[model samples]
Every structure is written in structure tokens, then in C-alpha cells.
Target chain A: MSWEIIKQSLPMFQQGFLLTLYLSLIGIIGSIIVGIICSLVEYFKIPVLNKILKVYIEISRNTPLLIQLFFLYYAFPAMGIKMSAQLCGIIGLIFLGGSYMSAGFSGGFNGVNKKQVESGKAIGLSRWQLARYVIFPQGFALSIPALAANIIFLIKETSIFTVIAIPELTNTALDLIGLYYNSNEYLFVLVVAYAIILIPLSIILTLLERRVRYGTFGN
Target chain B: MAHSGINVLFEGTNLTRLLLGMWTTFKIAAVAIIIGLIIGIILGILRTFHNPILRFVLRIYLEFFRIVPTVVLLFLFYYILPRQMNLHMPGTQVAMLVFSLWVAAEMSDIVRGALISVPIHQKESGLAIGLNKFQLYRYVLVPQAVQLELPATINLITRVIKTTSLLMLISVMDVVNIGQQIVEANNQKYPTGVFWIYGLIFLLYFLIDYPLSWWAGRLEKKRLEQTNGE
Candidate 1:
């Protein structure tokens, strides 16, 4: 409960905070890309790719992210393919978040009315144009709330990267605990740091979800 | 060059140890899910009551659990409580508490949604028949909510089971911990077997979870069809 020790560990915490942000940014971008690609593969019903994605999503969704991280960080090295823990942790997070996001995005895609797609076809738009103009926007709108919720889950899951010795927020707090022998103080700051980053995103998500629900994905 | 993966399991008590760990995983997850769902059903009912202060407090409780990472909560209970508050519990028990609280948060949300979705006219009709609050809920609301909540609650069971993997991080002897132990013991002789060993861990989880997920989907579809027909 000493402020002096907590102050001394502030620099370490700052560094960890930065790494957490970096990891989450990569996770968000990678998951969105992976999610969109998976959805597209499903939407078009690409035979081989869709089958692969089905298996990927099934396994990814069913397993815990921690075990998935172990597979990449610990298992791959045994197979003669070594990766840095940071690299493996981020990749694991992407795969974990991406599977869930793909499911959410596909829900949004399916929410697009069938008649709207038929009308788009009647308008003689190319399939690519049809998706780009008609489907993607509507689907993205419908998915905003689900996407936000998934992002929040992803943010919380990022804390698990510490188990792999990545110096994310949680690990940094643990490190500080070791150095300062004050688990209470360090974990307090750690919780605050995570909340500061997450709460605003959640608020924005709720607002956006409400707006979208009211049928005003504004022009 | 690595040793044979099959030999690692048959090499004395390794397989027995792993199966025991798997049993522990199931035991802890089952206890947590049941307790969480029971607590959640109560809170969910409370959440729908027309009391602003009660609803507000419930929201805070749910949001706090949802916002915190599971690992942090586990640490707070497993490490901090013992050291600071002199509240010591076994690692497995702590894991159960952490997960049960999380599951309760999730279950409460599901329950609230199902409860709210019950038609308003049903409640009105119950009141017209001179039913008390207890009788109304027992006869009308709880039954309807169960139909809506069953599939989502099944899905939550799969989630709780998968989350038990996190217990390994806290040094609980769950299946993943056993996998790690096997890898550590055999690292020198059978380095390549890490792939198969972890793959086996993945398959074990998939066996437990995939069927539940499939069943949940089927239940959800049936519920939807029933509602549509009605």
C-alpha cells in the first residue's frame, strides 16, 4: 500500500502499457482482416477454402486461447519451427479473436435481406461491385455491436499473453510485484490501466450499437 | 531427431496422469457451471424487478466481472487474498470461484434477456387470474425463460469447460497442466512430440466442446422453429 514503491514501478508499468496497446492494435487489425477474409470465403462458398475455414473456426472457437498460445509458442518449436513468444502470442490472439469475429461478421452478412441481393443482381452490378457497394456496408453496420463486444473480449484475452512471458500489462504488473513485493498496489494500477483503455471503447460500442439498432447507419 | 510420440504415453503412468487431470478439469467446470447458473438465475430474476437501485447494483456487479480479465481475478483470489487477507484456498477451489463468478455474469445476462423477452400479455394475463408474484413466475415466466435460455446456457457450459484451460496458468493440475508436465519431462528425449502432445490436448478439448456446441446450435434452431410456428 505504499505510494513510493508504486511510483518507483511506474516506468515499468508504462512500458508494459505501451506493449499491451501495441499487441491489441495488431490483434484488432489482424482479426478484422482474418474475419473479413473468412466471411468472404464462406459467402462465396469457395469449396476447399470454406472447408478449411470451417475446421479452423471450429477448432479455434472450441479451444481456450491459452492452450492455443501453448500450441504455437511451445508446440511449434518441437516441430523444428521456432517463434518468439511475442510473435506467437500475437498470432494466437489474432486466430482466437478472428474466429469469433468471423462468426459475428457472417451473422451480419446473413442479416442482409435476400431480396436486396436479388435487386443488386437485377441492377447488373458485377459480383465484386455488388459486395463492395451493397453487401459490405450493410453487413458492417449490422456487425458493429457484435464486433465491439468481440473487441472487448479480445482486450481481456490479451491479458493472458503474460503466461507466455510477453511483457504485456499483466506480466508487467507481475514483474513489479516481484520487484516491489507489493502485489496489491501493482495490481490496482494494472486494473486501472486496462479499464482506462477498455471502458471508452465499450461506451462507444454501446452508442454505435444503439444508433445502428434505431435504423440510422447514417449516410 | 526425436523419440516416438506413442511411446511417451505408454511409458509408465503418463496416460493415467493425463486422464486424471482431464477428470479434474471436468469436475471443476461442472461444479462452476451449475453454481454459476443457479446464482445467475436468481440475479437474473432480480434484474428484471422494477427497482432502480437493485438493478443498478446488479449492473455494476455484472459489468465488473465482464470487464476484468479471468487471469487477474484468479490471481486476486489465489495470490493476493492469501497474502493480504490471510484467505487461503486451494488453487483448484480458487479457479472454480473465479470461473463461477464469470459464468454467473454471463448467465445473468442471458437470463435477463430471456425473462424480458417473455410476452408482456402473459404477465398481464397472470395478474388477471389473481396470481401472486411467486405463483406467476413459477407457473408462467420461469417456464418460458427456460425455453429461451436453455440453448444459450448449454453454450455457456462449453465456454466454462474451455476456460478451465486457463487454470493451468495458475499451476492448477488441469489437462493443460498435465500436457505441460509431459512436455517438460520428455523435452530431452522426445522434443518433437510436443506437436502431437499438444495436438492431443486440443483434440481432448474439441471432443468435449464441439458436441456441446453442435447440440446448442440444434437446440437454438429448434427453438426458433417452434417460435416461428407459434
Candidate 2:
């Protein structure tokens, strides 16, 4: 409501925004890598790893990221494993994001046409060759929309890093409100800052989805 | 040290307190889902109609909830609403309000998708059979849609339950919050208790959510089998 509070808080919000961006970017990339490996393991029917991944996915998906962060930040230290808040935040994001992403990717992998795999096999392509030439591209393309949704979900999730004292955007806003009692202004700035980051990112992802769809299907 | 961590859980009323906190979480989620389901059904039915303005408004509502993080929304409602609107609600109520609105937005989409997926011939057949619009939906459309909607609705319920964990941020003392309190209280005496406390919270959530998810998957599979058989 007041420009004065908004003006004074912009710098802090900017710093918080950068941290959020950095955390989300790393989280997004880390999860995607984890997702790819996990999905591939499932796709190939790896024995021991497949069972472990299943349990991992179920546990990760069912629990909230906040609880996971709490366990990492608070509990791990007691168990003689020390991690900074930022590291805990990143690990939490990947831990949560990986399961969802793997679900999406595996859906794509399973949805790959049966006839295509057969044809690749008939053409004398090796297993690795078939996966490289036949499965991965189509599955990746098919997974794009789900991947985009997960990316946005991960970004929004970064808001909770405040609980671990990471000083992200939500934390900055909370801190400002605590110090100044100017809830309206700080919340307004917080919302606008998120809009600034998320709106454009969503638009870009949507565009990327469209581009991939058209590129792959020629529709 | 290993045994001490496990011992902390059974010490005093720590275990009971955690279960009570879990109950509070379930209560909030249950109330929110019920309220959200009622409103969402109406909004979803409205969305099926050819009303441009209503559709646009509903889209905005859905997008608003989709874009904003749940934590931020909780903070907005819990902190700002009392100051701006002079409404002093408890944190539990505020959490319920925000979550209900969120669930409603999500549920409406699920409902809309299920409703729209019902073939057009079913509605036309109902009209030709002397059924009025209300009866058409009640007898012909909704029953069919219910089968399609149930699995997704169950999934949404699980989502709502998981999200209720965020209520701790507003100081609603859900299971996670209680776990944190227990850990802090026992820090010196049972310094390794943190692992056990949080691990139990994690397992508790898994126990509650996994069954629902499994049920939803079974229903979805059954639906698929029925459709494929037809």
C-alpha cells in the first residue's frame, strides 16, 4: 500500500529473489538428472536398484518437502551428518522433485510406441542404440509438459526454504513484516516478486512445450 | 545412543501428542476437502455450461491458486486478513479457509474434465427420453462422471492431506510442528532423538498417504479395465 515500504524493501527482496532463482535452478536441474537416471533404471528393469527406487519414489512423493527439510536440517546433524540450510533446501527439493519427475518421465517412457521398439530391434539396433535412437527422444518430448509443470511446482516450493532459515523471498517478506508490521506492503512486494519470476518462466515453459509438441509431431 | 533415540518416542506423552497433532492435521484436511468438494462440484457444473464470463472468472481463480505457493497464501490469510479486514480467525480456521479454496480450484478442474469426458450422446439420449435438464445430469451424466471422477478425487484428497503439513508454518501445531517441539524439548537428554522424531513423522505421513494412493491406483486400473472391456 505504501511506496515507502516497497521502496525500502526492494533490495532485500532482490537478494531473496536471486537466492530463490539459484536454488530453484539447481533443484530443477538436479531433479531432472535424478529423474532421468531413475526412469532409465526402471525402463531397463534394473534389479536391486529398481526396488530401491520404488521405495524412494513412494516415500518422497507421499511426504511433504517441509518435513523432509526438517529431517535434513535438524535430524541429520544429530546423526553426525552436517549440512547447511542451503544444502538442505536443495536436497529437499531434489528429493521431492525427483519422484514426481521420474513419474512423468516413466509415463513417457512407457507410452513410447511398442511397434517403434520392435522396429528398432528388427533393424539390428543394439539395446543402447535402440534406447538412444528410439526411446529417449520420443520419451523426452512426451514428458515436456509434465516436466514444465514440475518445474513450476519446484519453483513455488522454494518458498518453504524459509523454515530452514534460507532467507528466500518468503522469508524476506516475513522478516520485513516482523520488523516493520507492514504486512500489506511486504506481501504485495512478495507477490509481485513471485509474479515477476514465475509468470515469465511459465510463459517460457508453455512456449517450450508448444515448440516441442510441434517439432516432434508436425501437428 | 541408538537405543536412546528410540526410547524418546515412548517417553511420557510424546507419542500421544504426535498422534493428536496428526489428528488435527487430518481434521483440517477433512473439513477443507468436504467444503471444497461441494463448492467445486457446483463450479465445475457451471464450467460445463457455455458461459464465457463464468468460464473466464473460474479460470482466473484456478490460475491464481495454481501460481501462488500455498505457504505464501497461508501467510497472507493468517497475517494480513485480520489487519486489513478486521477479521480475527484462528490459525486452524485460516488454514482451512485457504486450503478449501485451493482444493476447490483443483477439484473443479477435475470435475470439469470428468464431466466433459462423458460422451455427448448420453446427454442427448436423456433429453429424448423425456428427462429434464436436472434429471438429465442427475440420472444420465453425473453417474457416469462419478466413476471417472472418483480416482482423481481420491488422488486430490491425498494431495490435500499432504499439503496440510504446511499448516505448521502458520503455527497450527500439526504433526511436524509437534515433532519439532518434542525434538527441542529432548535435545539435551536425547540429543539423537531428532532422527527418530522426524523419521516417525515421515513414516506417519507415508502410512496415511500410501493407502489412499494405492486405492486410487486400484480404482484407476479398474476404470481402465472396464473401459478396455467395453
Q: What interface RMSD does every candidate have?
A: 1.1, 0.9
Query: In model 2, how large is the Cα lDDT of residue B10?
Result: 97
Q: Tell me the tens digit of each residue's lDDT in model 2 across B1-230.
A: 45578889999999999999999999999999999998998888888989999999998898788888999999989988899899999999999999999999988988898899899999888999899988987888888888899998998898888888888889998998898899889988898899999999989989999999889989987886676567
lDDT of 2 by residue, A1-219 (tens): 889879999999999999999999999999999998899999898999999999999899888898899999999998899999999999999999999899889977765767788999999999999989999988888888889989999999999899999999999999999999999999988988888888877787779877876865673
After superposing candidate 1 on the true structure, give the runs of residues whose Cα lies further than 4 Å from its correct spot: A113-134, A216-219, B223-230
Evaluate model 1: give its TM-score: 0.93
Interface RMSD against the true structure, candidate 1 = 1.1
* DockQ of each model vs. true complex: 0.71, 0.75
- TM for every model, in the order presented, reads 0.93, 0.93
lDDT of 1 by residue, A15-46 (tens): 98899899998998899999989999998899
Error of 2 at A127 (Å): 5.2
Task: Please report, as a residue range, the 10-residue window in candidate 2 chain B with the lowest summed lDDT.
Answer: B221-230
Badly placed stretches (over 4 Å) of model 2 are A113-130, A204-219, B1-3, B224-230
Error of 2 at A169 (Å): 0.6
